[model samples]
Target: MVTAIVLAAGNSLRMGTQNKLLLPFAGTTVIAAVVEQIVKAGLQELIVVTGNEPDLVHQALIHLPVKLVHNAGYGTGMTGSIQTGIQSAKGNGYMICLGDMVLITAQQYESLNTTFEKAYHRDKTCICLPRFNGVKGNPVIFSSAYKNAILQHDDPEGCKAIIQANNPHIVWVEMDDDAVLRDMDYPEDYAALINL
Candidate 1:
C-alpha cells in the first residue's frame, strides 16, 4: 500500500488568485480533477494537505472520500506540508503529489508504479521520479529505505535538499507524457489547458 499525499496548501503568489487549486481546468477545478485522477489510479488512499483557505478546500473535496489535514505552518513553506504528509503516510512508500498538477494522468502514475514494483522486487531503493522531455515532475515515489532520509529533512527547502543529498539513490523513470510537466499557476496556463 503506497500513501498518496496531495499537497494543496500554498498561496498562489504568481497566479494572483485566491484559490489556484480550485481554479477550473476544462470544466472541473484542478484539485477536484487531479484528486479524481489519483483516486482512479488505485495507488492507495488519498490525503489532502490544506492551508491558507481550509474551509474552501474542504468544501471542494466534500464529495471525495479523502482525509484532509490542514498545515498551520504552510505559510512558512511547502516543507511543512511535505513533512506533515510524510509523517502521516502509511505503508512502505509514498507517492507525494501536488494539488496543482492537473495534467497528470493515470498512465503516468502507472509508469512510476511499475518502476517502484520493479525496484522493490529487486531489493533496490525505489525513488520513482517522472521525467518528461528531460524535465522532472512531481508525485515522486520515495521508497521505505529513504524514510529516515525524508523524515530527517529539516532545512525547510522542500525536496531539493533531499534530492540533491541523495542523488545516488534517485531512480529516474522516463515518461513521454507532457502533462507531467504542466502545472497551472497563472491565467495563461488555464487558458492553454482550455485551448487544448
Candidate 2:
C-alpha cells in the first residue's frame, strides 16, 4: 500500500491575510480540490497534516475518506508538519505532496505512480520525483529503506536535506504537467494557477 501524505498545515504568513487553502478555485476550496484529486487518483489511504485552521481543514475534509492529524508545532515551519504527516503514513511507501499544489490530474498522478513503480520493481530503494520542464516537482515517492533516515531528521524542512544528500538514489521522471510545480504561496499564486 502507498499512502499519500498531504501537508496542509502552516499559518500561511506569506499569503498576506487570506486562508489560501479555503479559497475557492473551480467551485471548491483549493485544499478540497487537491484531496479529491488524490481520491480520484485511487489513493484511498490519505493522511492530511493540518494546523492553523484545524477545524476548518477538518470540516473541509469531512466528506473525504481522509484521516486528519494535527501538527502541534506547525508554527515552527513546514518540516514539523511534514514529520507529523510522515509519522501518520500507514503504508510502507509514501507519496508525500503539498496541499497548496492544485491542478494535478489523475493522469499526472498515474505518471508519478508509474515512475516509482518502475524504480521499485528494480529492487532498489529509490525515490521517484517529478521533473517538470527540467525542474523538480512535488509528490516524491520514497521507498521504505529511508524510513530510519527520515525519522532522524530534526530539521524543520524534513526530507530536503536527505533528498539532497541522496540524490543518487532518486529517479527523476519527466512530466508535462506544470501543476506539479505550482504551489499557492500567495494570492498571486491563485491567479497564476488560474491563468495557466
The most accurate candidate by TM-score is 2
Q: How close to the true structure is residue 195 of candidate 2, measured as C-alpha lDDT? A: 75
> Per-residue lDDT tens digits of candidate 2, residues 129-164?
888899999888888777777867888766878788
Clashing pairs in 1: none
Best by lDDT: 2
Could you give candidate 1's per-residue lDDT for residues 98-180 as a string of tens digits? Answer: 88888888777767777877777775575778887889888788876777777677877577776777677778888777787
Deviation in angstroms for 30 in model 1? 0.9
Q: Give model 2's TM-score versus the native structure.
A: 0.94
